[model samples]
Every structure is written in structure tokens, then in C-alpha cells.
Target chain A: MSEAVDAFNIMVYRQLKRFVRAKSRLFGSIVNPLIWMVFFGLGWSSLFKGSMAKALFGGYSYLDFLAPGVVMMTVFMGGFISGVTVLWDKEFGFLKELLVAPASRTAGMAGRAFGDALVATIQGALILAAIIPLARDINPGGIPVTLAAALLTGFAFTSLGITIALKISSMEGFHIIVNFIMMPLLFLSGAFFPIDPLPEWMKVLAYLNPLTYSVDLARISMLGSGSMNPLIDTVVLAASSLILIGSAALLFREATID
Target chain B: MDAIVAENLTKRFGELVAVDHVSFKVKQGEIFGFLGPNGAGKTTTISMLITLRKPDEGEAWVAGLSVAKKPAEIRRRIGVVFQDPSVDRELTGWENLWIHGVIYGVPKNSLRRRIRSLMEFVDLWEKKDTPVKHYSGGMVRRLEIARALIHEPEILFLDEPTLGLDPQTRAKIWDYIEDIRRREGTTIFLTTHYMDEAERLCDRVAIIDHGRIVALDTPENLIRRLGGDVVYLHSSSDRLEELASMLSETGLASDYKIIDGKLMLSVRDASKAMPEIFEAARKLGVKISEISYKRPSLGDVFLHYTGRSLRDSEGSWKETARIVVRRRR
Candidate 1:
């Protein structure tokens, strides 16, 4: 049992160390989410100062409403991009090394998911740190809970990402496939805008999206502008995170060297 | 007890049989070599033994545990250096070794001690902190060898370990392997198509051809089984092949072969057979332009069994021969 734990910790340690080693890769991946936050936050500035804005935003600014969304986007993109490492490992033949090791593949998968999610959470945390001072009515102590929610969501997304990347053999194929699915998952998750005024069909997609619940959970904790009960939102995200992680582990056990 | 055993092991992909009913055994602390050309089932057999691929028909045992029933136990006792580079290039050399040790459940102090000794043994101690990506090809291979030993496994499996390295580097890698064998008495199971690599590093070699063991013995024994000497005959004759059959019928030579535009005849005494050989050539109107004799090599055994050179078309000869035989039936 201790050996299994050691395997998990070492795999996660390897990922984190590589993450620190390749600053350019980390920097390149976060660039897109940074652009989304800056452009959208500036474009919608000064629109939430009146009492009419209070009803719409629950006494928070548009920038604050979009802060959690943008942070989730960072974590979301970070998690999604993490799966490319598996493809890279497969291409470079390092996956064979890990598979032949005495440790369990499930342990490696769990550790990888943990490491990528934590690294993604760092991006989410950095975005929050940058936007918190510029925004108003922020709770300093609530940051940990919000980050935990974001990490759980990140783990869920990264697990799903690995599942898809397992079937894809090339980096170029993964990029094309992720772009097609990610944009739709992001836009329909009520990320850039609330789902209040969307068409009936679009609302259902937003409701079904696990990303919507994750972002909503963070918004409630960070901005207190949530549309649903925080408990229900947290429960849904946590349960699905477990489900996705379990599924990822199952698929990982069957991963062949071929 | 045999350190490793495969009983009627078989693996197939669609219509192609990658490893067909192959069985073998490896004794403890022995160097076992599986020699074959590309696509001759060497990799498939190693994969099955190491539990990387499951056998379709039979079973394998490593360290006295059935591979199909207890793969984890076999994996725990074995170390593998793949034909491809399997080290994490992003990690430092020391870090790669450390991760392997940790995963194998090597205790901290023992792991540290083995890492120190193995790194020094492989001459990679100075580059332990360098990321593996910057290391040259030989350095990465040496570092991988060090990593595979960090866990102190009983049996080591190396697949084409010296495929693309320079000759000097290849010799250096073999020196490290020899050092390991002398110090730990670890049994090594390596697969390679390079004839000399099997001759140089292995105690016993199994020559696999078309998913079967065509020959298995010490290099000297297999070569001796071919003949004492190999006579190379290069002649000018439009009917050289017909000349070969004529010579065989005239009690001059049997099992003559044409390879690389030269007629090779395995002779027990080349000097004693020279008179008859020249007379047979004279009768067939084929002049022996150049003739030389040398001690037989593993190459002769390979040709003797498969009737083709290792460098002959990669897996094509086997396919063509199989098709012709099938049509003949």
C-alpha cells in the first residue's frame, strides 16, 4: 500500500517538476484564457454601477461575474491541454516505461490527473489574484474553497481529456479534435454570458454541461451571484469528478504499449 | 529451476502469426539471446515473456510465477530496456532513476546506494543532473541501463540495446553490461538481429525465423554445426545455379548456396576439397575467378537454416516462401 502511494506521489512530482521546467509551454497554454479575460472584462466595464445592475449581478460588477468564468476557463484549458502530454509520451515511447514499471497504471493515471489539475489550479489561482484587487466586495477567506472547486472541476475535465487523448495517436489530431469539442463545451456552459436569456435548447445544454455547474459553484463562492444552491452545485461537480476519474482509471488499465 | 520458461506460447495479429508455438527456457544467471531479423518474432516473444503482451494460446513463467496468472509478480522481478528510448527526456538523469526505484518499492537508503553505484558503473555520474533531452544518443542509452538496474532486478530484458550507436559506444555499453553480470550475476535476456551482438554478449542464442526457433545453441556450437570453414566461390557463368546442382550430383558438394552473387559451400576441410571443387568447376565450364576460405560464422548458420541472408529483404523472403509452399500444396 505504501509503495502504491509512493508511485502516486512520484508520478505527480515528475509532472510538477516538468511543469516548472517548461515555463514556455505553461505560458503558451494560459495565453488564450488571459486574452478572454482581458478583452471581455474591459469591453463590459462600467456597465454595472446602477441599482438596475444590482438586480442583474446581485451587487457585483460584470468583471466580477466573469472572473470565475475566466478562471474556470484557465483551469479548463489547462486541464484540457494536459492530455497532450500522454500523446507526447506515447509518441516518444515513455508510456512503455511507465507501463512496465512495477506500479499500477491506475496509480499513474490518478497521479497524472492530480498533477495536471493542481497545475491548472495554479493558473486559476493566479487569475483570481490578479482580478481580486481590481474588483469589489471580495471575500479573502473564501479563495481556498473556490480554488478547491476549480481543482475538482479541473480533475474531471483532465480525466475526460485523457480518455479522448488515449484514442488519438497524434498531437495534431488531438488539437483539431479538442478545438471542435472545447469551443462548444465552453460557449454553451454559460461561461461568457449567463444562460438566463438563451433559447430553450441552449439552456438545456448549459444545464447539462458539467462545466456550467463548476463555474457556477465558483461564482457563488467568489461573487455570491450563483443561480443555484451552492451545495447542490458542489455535490454535482464532486460526484461527476469522481465518476470521470474512475472511468479514466479503468481506461488507463487497458492502455497498451501499441 | 528455470528462471524463465515459455510453453507453447503463441501470439497472432489478424492473419499473421507473430509468435507461433515457441517454447524455451532460461537458466538463472545466464545470458540468453533471441537473435532474428526484423519481423521474425523476436519482439513478440520478449513482449510475451515480460507480460507486455498476452499470449493467444499458451503461457509463460518468469521467476517461477505464471505470466498469465501473476504478471505483477513477474514485473516486480524483471527490468526491461526497450528497443526504443523509454526514459522521460524532460527529467534529469538522476530523477529518472529515482522514479523507477520508487515505483519498484526500493527502500530509500538501498535505492540511493544502488543509484550511486549504478550511475558510477555506467559512467553517467557526472551527468546525473542534466536533463536527458540534452544528452547524446549514447548517453541516454547508458542512463537507461543505469535506471533499469536501480531496482536490482534478477532478470534484465534488453531489446536491441545497441541498435544505432557508434561501434565504440556500443562496446562501451557492452562493457557496462558485462560489469553488471559480473557484479550481480543477473540473468540477461536480450533480442537483436545483429549477429555479432549475439556472438559477443550472449552465453546461448536462439535463432528465430518465421515465428519459430530455427536454431538454438552457443554461437560456436551453431557455427560448428554448419561446417569447419566456409568457402566463397565467385565465378563467371551464365549457368552458375545449374553448375551448383551438377556439382552436388557429382559428389563434389551438397547444400551449395548462391548469395550476394557468390557461391558459398560449407566444407569440413577446404584444402582437401579444393581439388574436387576445381574439377567440378572445370567440368561445368565455370571458372572460379576468386576463392577464399574462412572459419564459419553465425551468418552461415542463419543461411543454412533459412536459405537466405539476414540482410535479405525484410520479412519478404519468408512471406514469398510461404506463399510458394502454399501454392505447391
Candidate 2:
């Protein structure tokens, strides 16, 4: 047990050090969501407001509806790119050093996912901090729940990223695969729009996406109103996070080193 | 007890057998070398023994545990430095060593002190705060050696440890390796194609080629197997085979072969054989253009066993082109 803990802590420590050292990555993750909140959220919100927007956003403004989505998007995009670090390690040969250590592969990968998730959640929190003043209707009591949703979203997507990273060898292949999977999932998750107004086929995809549960949960916590019950959103997001984490661990355990 | 043992260990990639049915035992605290040219199964054999790759045909044991059965146990007891550099370039030297110690389960209290002493030992103490990307190649290699010892493993496996380094740095790295074995009593297993490195550092060498070990013995014994000195006789006549037969029949040469249009003779005493060799060449009307003899080297033994010199096997089309371009100039 101590062995696993040691491996896990050290991997987290390593990832954090790498994340902090790259100043641009730190600055960019925070700035990215703010751009979406300002350009996309406010831009679209101005054109669609009052009773029609209130009906669409459950009495909240379009900016308030878009606030939680932007926060979840920050976490989602941050977690999705976590595997690029793993791919770099593989390319630069650091993965061999990690793999040959006495520590379990599952522990190492879990540590990586946890570290990535933590960074992604922090980025989400920063975006929330920025959004709190710009967007009204955020319940101060639901801040904890919003952070929890961010963390869970981070863990799920980071694990998903790592699972894909373990399969793809080259950077080009990783970007191609991740971007291919990411664009559809992001658009289909109803982050940019309401799922209720979507066509049946698009609504089904939104329901099927794990990101949808996270976005819904974030919406419930921040706006105090969402499409699904808060309990259902929480349970689905938690289950998907565990499933993705487990899959990443299993793939890491069977991964071969050269 | 042997620190490591392999019985018919083999690994294949698609149709290519990377490591053949190779077997050897590394005794406790001894420095053993796998000497071979590129793609000669050295790295594959080390990978199998280190538990990175499983043997396809047979099993191996490391630190008394079977590689196939107890790979985790073996990993805990052994340290490896791969041929390619594997350090985290973004991290400081100190951070890299600290992470390595923690991951290896070294007690947190002692890890800092251990990392300090290791850094000092490798002469990287002053540069510990610097990121590895800024480090020289030699400094990174030393840092890796220090990191590998973080666990104080019983056996250390280095696959081409000093490859792509200058002679001075290679020798310096060799000193560090010897010091590790002498001070810590760590059994060292290294692979290299450099004859001088094998002769200087290893107690026993296994000459591997074409996915097999063709010879295994102490450097002296392996060289001694060549019988005596190597006599290089460059004859004016292209019919070197006729001269080889004459020298062999006259008992002037114990063994002879035509290499690069030169009659290479392995003789008991080159001085005694030289006069007789000249007489034989005179009788055949074949004038000896160049006559030189030297003590047999590991390269000669490799040639004697594999029928090819290690140095001569590395000529590529690019190298040939460079030579042709230089001649034109």
C-alpha cells in the first residue's frame, strides 16, 4: 500500500512540477475560457435576451446559462489535452523510466489522471472566479458542487485522454484522434446551446455524452436549475468518471515498454 | 549466488528474432558485459532480463526471482539505464532524483540526503538546480546513473551506457560504474560494442551477433583463444588464398584468413613465423608489401569466432558516399 502511495504521490508531484514550469500552459488554460465567456457567451447573450431567453434558460439570462458551460468546457478541454504529456513522455523516453519503476502501472496512471484532473479543476475554478462577477445567478452555496462537477469532469476526460494516449504512439496520430473525438463530443454535449431545443437525434447524443452529465451538474449547481435532476447528473458523472479511470488503469497495466 | 540467470531467453518482433535462445549467468558483484555490434540482440537480451520485454521461448531469473513469474519483484531489486536517454528534461536535476527516489519507495526522510550524496558523487551537485535540458550529455548520463541507484538495487543493468560520448567522458563514466560496484557491491551488467570498453571494464564478456552469443569468457581468455599474435601481411598478389594455404601447410601460421585482400595469420610467435612467412611468400613469387603484427585484441577474437570484424560491419552507404566525396575533393 505504501509502495502504491509513494508511486502515486511522486507521479502527481512530477506532473505538477511540469505543469507549473511551463508558464504558457498555465496562462493559456485560464485565458481560453474567458475568451469563450466574453466573445461567444456575451456576444450570443446580447442578441437573445428577455422572456424568450428566460424561457430557454429557465428564467436565467443567456450569460448565466453559458457561464457554467464555459467553466465545464475549461475543465473538459484541459483534461482532454492531459494525454499530450503522456505522449511526450513516450516520445522522449521518460515513460520507460516510469514503467520500469517498482511501482504498479495502475498507481502511476491513476496518479497521472488525478494530477491532470486537479490541474483541470483549478483551471475551471479560475474560470469560475472570472465568471462570478460577469455572470449573475450563481448561488454561492452551490460553489462546492460546481467545483465537484469540475473535478469529476476533469478526472473522466483526463482518463479518457490517457486511454487514447496509451494506444496512439505518434503526436500527429494523438492530435488527429483526440480532435476527431473531441469536436463532436464538445458540440453534442449542449455546452453551447440548450438540449431541450435540439432535434431528437442531437438530444440523444447529448444525453449519451458523459460531458453532458458534467455540464448539466455544473448548470444545476451554478444556476440552481438544469434539464435533469441534480441527483441523476451527479450519479451519472461519478459513474462515468470511475469507468474511464478504470479503463485507463487497465490499459496502462497491459502497456508494453520498448 | 548469481545475481541474474537466463535459460534459453528469446524474443521476436514479427518474423525477426531479436534475442535468440541466449543463456548466461551474472555472478554476484561482478561486472559482466554483452559485447556486440548494432542489432546484435544485446538490448533485447537486457530488455528480457530487466522485465521490460518477456522472453518468447524461455525464462530468466533476476535477483533470485523468475522474470516471467515475478517481474515486479525483479524490478524492485534491479535498476536499469537504457541505451537512449530517459530523463525528464523539464525538471531540475535535484527534482528528477527526488522523484526517482520517492517512486522507488525510498524513505522520504533519507531520500533528500541520498539525492544530495549521489549528486555530489556524480559531480552534479552544483548543477542540481538546473533543468536537465541545459545539461551536457555527460552530465545527463551521470544523473541517470545516480537516479538508477536511488533504490540501491542489488543488480544494475546498463544497455550501452557510454554510447555517443567522447573518449574522455566514456572513461569518466566507466570510473563511476567501477566505483559503484566497488563501493556498493552492486553487480553490474552492461552492453557495449567498444572492444576497449569491454576489455577495460568487464570481468566477462559475451560476444553476441545475429541474435546469438558466439563467445563468452574473460577478455584475456577470449583474446587468448585466438592462439597468439595477429600478423597482417598485405601481398602484392591478389591470390591471397594461395599464400594462406602455404603458410598453414608450412606450420608458419596456426590459423589464416584473407581479409580485405590481406593474409591475416594467427600465429604462436609472429617473429618466428615472419621469417618463414617471407620465405613461403618468396617461393610463391608473392611479394609482401606490408608486414605488421600485434598482440591479439578482442576484435580479433570476435573475427575468429564470427568470421567478421566488428569494425568492418558498420560501413553504410552514407559513410561510403562521404568517403567518395572526400576523395573527389
Candidate 3:
């Protein structure tokens, strides 16, 4: 038990140390959401006022409606980019070193995924903190719940992203997956705008996406507003996290480091 | 007791046999060299023995634990240094060792001292705090060796340890490996394409080719088996076979073969055999362009066993080389 705790601390420290060394990567994770919040959210605010935006965001203002989406966007983007560590490890041959170590496979995956999820949660929280003065309606009563929602969302998405990265063998394949899956998941999950404004098919697909539940839960926690039940959203996100994490662990079990 | 024992261990990828019924044993404290060409399954065999890859048939026991059934047990007792630099470049050398030590269940009290000693052993103590991304190729490799040694396992496996490094750095690594072995009596399993590396460091070597073990013996014994001296004679292409036939007829040497536009003849005494060799060439209308007599090296031994030079067989980058290591649950 002591060994396990030591291993976890070491793994977390390793991640933190690497992150500090590669501040540029951390910056990259932040830039996308910041741009969306400042430029897109502001620009679309006037264009999406009242009826059109209300229909999409359950009657919230465009800027207010977009904050939760932006938080979820950060989670999705950060989660997808978490796989870059795996790519870097492969290229640098550090993956083999980690595999040969005495740590369990579950520990290895959890260590990395937890690091990414933590970063995602922090980035989401920071974005929320930055936008708090702008979105005055965001309740102080919901701060803890909003943070919990953001963390759960980050954990779920990052696990999925890491699993994809582990299963895909090449850098090119990883790129294709990120571009094809992550972008669509982000846009359709109502992160930038609401899915109700989109075609009927996309609305259904958005509901199916795990990111939607995260966004809904985050919005409800922060603004005390959401179309879906908070319980349902939490359940969906939690279930998705478990399934993705389990699949990743299983994939790691089967895959051999060359 | 044997540190490792592999019996008819085999692994196949689709239709291609990566390791074919390979068998060998390493006693405790022996430096066993696994010598082979690029696609000769040296790494594959090592992977199986290390429990990184599961074999399709047969079995291997590492430190008395079955590689197939008890990989965790095997992992606990063995250290591995892959051919590729496995040290995390983004972390400091000290951080890398610390993480590895922790993963291996080293107590925090002992971890710091162990890491310092390991870094000092690998000559990376001064640079321990510096991130490995700033390290040179050789420094990264040294740190990797240090990382592998952190747990103080009874056996250490180094796959092509000095590949693609300058001779000076390679020599330093070899010296470090030797020093570690001497100090700890650790059983070393090393793989190399370089004959000189095998000759210098290995107590015994197994020459593998095409997923099969071709020869297994001490380097000295293998060279001795190829005969005392190797005579390199460059002659006209037309008379190459004729010269070989004439040498065969003289029966002065037990082994003779043509390689790379030159006829290499092995004999007991090159000084006495040189006259007969020249006479045989002359009678066959062979005009010798270059002639040199030297004792048989591991290169000669490899060529004799595998029918190809190690240099020619390396760095193909064929699909066979793309091995993925997945965690086993």
C-alpha cells in the first residue's frame, strides 16, 4: 500500500515536472478556448441575441450560454492533446522505458490520464474564473458543483482520448483521429453554440455525445440552467469515463511495446 | 542455477516467424551476448524472455519464474535497457530515476541514495537535475542504463546498447557495463550486431539468423572453430570459383569461402599455408589483387555460420522491426 502511494506520487510528480518543462504545450491547450471565448463568443453575442440564441441555449444570453460550452471545449481539446505525450514517448523511445518499469499497466495509464484530466480541469476552472465577472449571473452557490462537473468531464474525455492514442499505432493516424473525432465532438456538443440551432440529425447526435452531458452539467452548475436532468448528465459522464478508462486499460494489456 | 532458460520458445507474427524454436540458458553472473542481424529475431527473443512479448510456443523462465505464466515475477527480478533511448527526455535524469525507482517499489528512504549512486555510476551525477531533453545521445543512453539499474535486479538485459553511437561513447558504456557486472555480479543479457562488441564484452554469444540460433559458444571458441587464420585474397571474378576448387583440392585448409568479390580461406598456419594458397591461385589463372592474412575474428565466425555479413543484414527497417509493446493485464 505504501509502495502504491509512492508510485502514484512519483507518477503525478513526473507529469507535473514534464508539464513545467514544456510550458508551450500547456499554452497550446489554453489558446484555443481563450480565442473561442474572447473573439467568437463576443462577436456572436449580438448576432445570437434573444430568440435565435435562446432557442439554442434555453433562453440564456449568447455570452452566458457559450461559457459552459467553452469550458467543455477546453476539456475535449485538452483530452485529445493528452495523446501527444504517447506520440512523443514513442518517438523518443520513452514509452518502452515506462513499460519495462515495475509499475502496473493500470497505474501507468491512470498516472498519465489523471495528469491530463487535472490540467484540463485547471484550464477549465481558470477560464471560468476569467469569465465570471463577464457572466454575472453565474451563481457563487454553484462553484463547487461546477468544478466537480468540469473535473468529471475532463476525466471522461481525457480517458477516451488517451485510449484512442494508445490503440492507434502511428502519428498520422493520431492526427486523423483528432481532426475527425475531436473537432466534431467539440462543435456538436454545443461548446461554441447550441446544437438546437443546428439540423435535427445533429441535435440527436449531440445528445448522444458524452461532451453534451458535460456541457449541460457544467451549464446547470454554473448558471442554474440546463435542458437535461443534472443527475442524468452526471450519470452519462461517469459511465463514459468508466467505459473509456476500462477499454484503455484493456488495450494497454493487449498491446506490446516494440 | 540458470538465471534464464528458454526452451524452444517461438513467436510468430501472422505468417512470419519472429522467433523460431529458440533455446538457450544463461547461468547467474554471465554476460550472454545475443548476436544477430537486423531481422534475426534477437530483440524478439529478448522481448519474449523479458515478458514483453508472449511466445507462440514453448517456454522461458527468468529467475525461475515462467515468462508466460508469471511475467510480473520475471519483471521484478530483471532490468531492461531497450535499443532505443527509453529515458524520458522532458524530465531531468534524476526525476526519471526517481520515478522508475518508485514504480519498482523502492522505499523513499533508500530511493534518493540509490538514484544518486546510479547517476554517479553512469557519470550523470552533475547533470542529474538537468532535463534529459538537453542531454546528448550518449548521456541519454547512460541515464537509461542508470534507470534500469535502479531496482538492483539480479539480471540486466541490454538490447543493442551501443548502437549508433561514436566509438568513444560506446567504449565508455561498455566499460560501465563491465564495471557494473564486476561490482554486482549481475547476469547480463546483451544483444549486438557489432562483432567487436560481442568479442569484447560477452562471456558467450549466440549467433542468430532468420529467427534461428546458428551458433552458440564463446567468442574465442567460435573463432577457433573457424580455424586459426583467415586469408583474404582478392582475385579476378572469372577464376574465383576455380581458385576455391584448387584450394579445396590441396586440403591444406578445412574452410574456404568467397565473400564480397574476395576469397577468404581459413587454415591452421597462414605463414606455411600462404605458399600453397598462392600456388593454387596461380594454377587457376587467378591474379591476386590484394592479399592479407589475419587471425579469424567474430566477423569471420558470423559469416561462416550465417552466410552473410552482419553489416549487410542490419538497418533494413522492414515491417518486421515494427514491434509494439502493450501492457499485459
DockQ values per model = 0.50, 0.37, 0.47
Clashing pairs in 2: none
Q: What TM-score does each of the candidates earn?
A: 0.87, 0.87, 0.87
Deviating ranges (above 4 Å) for candidate 2: B226-301, B309-329
Per-prediction TM-score of chain B?
Answer: 0.79, 0.79, 0.80
Q: Candidate 1, residue B19: CA error in Å?
A: 0.6
Q: Which stretches of model 3 miss by more than 4 angstroms?
A: A50-56, B229-299, B308-329
Clashing pairs in 3: A255-B326, A256-B324, A256-B325, A256-B326, A257-B324, A257-B325, A257-B326, A258-B323, A258-B324, A258-B325
State in Å the error of residue B112, model 2. 1.8
In TM-score terms, candidate 2 sits at 0.87
Per-residue CA lDDT of model 1 for A1-258, tens digit only, reads 787798889888988988898989777766776677677676776655666765666466777778788888888888877855688888788888888877988888888888999998998888788777656766777788889998998888888788777776666787676778788889987667788778999999888888999888888888765888888888888888888888878877877665
Top candidate, metric lDDT: 2
- lDDT value, candidate 2, whole model: 0.86
- Winner of 1 and 3 under lDDT: 1
| Model 3 chain A poorest 10 in a row by lDDT | A1-10
Report the C-alpha lDDT of model 3 over A1-258, residue by residue, as the tens digit.
565566556666776677678888778777878888889888988788768667766778888888888877887777667744577677677777667665677767766777777777887777778787766678788878877887777777767877877766676777787789988898888776667668999998998899999888888988888878999999998998889878877776676765
Worst 10 residues of 1 chain B by lDDT: B320-329
